[model samples]
Target: MHRRASPGSQDHFDLFPYIAILMSLLGALLTATLGMASLSLGPGVAETWDMAARDGTASKAPVLVEWDGSALTVHEGAQRRRVPWLDDQAAAAGGMRPRSAAMQRLLAEFGQRSATGYVLFAVRPSGFATLPRLTDDFRAAHIDIGYEPVGQERGVQLLSAGEHP
Candidate 1:
């Protein structure tokens, strides 16, 4: 025959299970409070470099270029150079395009050489026109593309492909 515990003994045994349940509830409550606090206290997210604009104007950012020079050099506090094809086009056609294959190749080489932040391309309006395709191509090759306008002209829109003004 089973014998029931005395009242004092039963009370003592019940205290442990009550304490365990209390502790579990407290732990769960603490975890949920911490999670909510974190959600409310985190800093705002930063915008992508390509989406950055300043003072109602598109700012010029640094870009890496591969020139004919022997050693890597940082010009104007950042490395930038004119490719051979760009030079040839400037000489022959009196104008150069920044979105050409040569420029892309230079950008690729620069990206491979540096461990710095994203590469910025100082492009003209014409160059900006080709940016969407270039960005796509770069992404396909696993490269990130960021761009900025170079000249002082205002009211120019640098839209990616399929972007509406």
Candidate 2:
């Protein structure tokens, strides 16, 4: 003779399997919730860049300028100096003429070496019309030309690279 499970015992036996399945589902839900929470608060791209630069692998350079910011500071680097002539002043000094042969030779040497990136020019508003032709000549010789127009009030007008007219 064999003994069978009582009704109460059978109910308990069936409940154990359902309880195990519920516990597994709850664990999965908890894991997904924690993952999403962690993802919502993380560092961004700029922070990473700051950290990398601070660690000392890369360096940055300062921007170029004609004059140093402080009045006391004098810039002594290589630069182009302009000589302008007004109508009466130019007439008094005599009409415009070609650059001296020695100066032309020096310019040719400078152009060949490519030591300078640009030749800064200062011209009057009335001389603006001649700039396009000057730019063309520089372009043909593989030299970049830049200019700043000085106004009556001594304002600066920057001419962009490759800009004409």
Candidate 1 local lDDT, 1-93, one digit each (tens): 999888767543348888999999999999999999888755542222233453545333334321222211123332344443333445477
Q: Residues 19-131, candidate 2: write the lDDT tens digits.
A: 99999999999999999877874332111101123345433311112221111111123343332212334455788644444434534643674443444444445556665
- The top-ranked prediction according to TM-score is 1
How much lDDT does each candidate structure score?
A: 0.48, 0.43
Where does the lowest 10-residue lDDT sum fall in candidate 2? 67-76
The segments of candidate 1 whose C-alpha lies over 4 angstroms from its true place after superposition are: 1-80, 84-107, 113-115, 152-165
TM-score of 2: 0.31
lDDT of 2 at 87: 33
Pairs clashing in candidate 2?
none
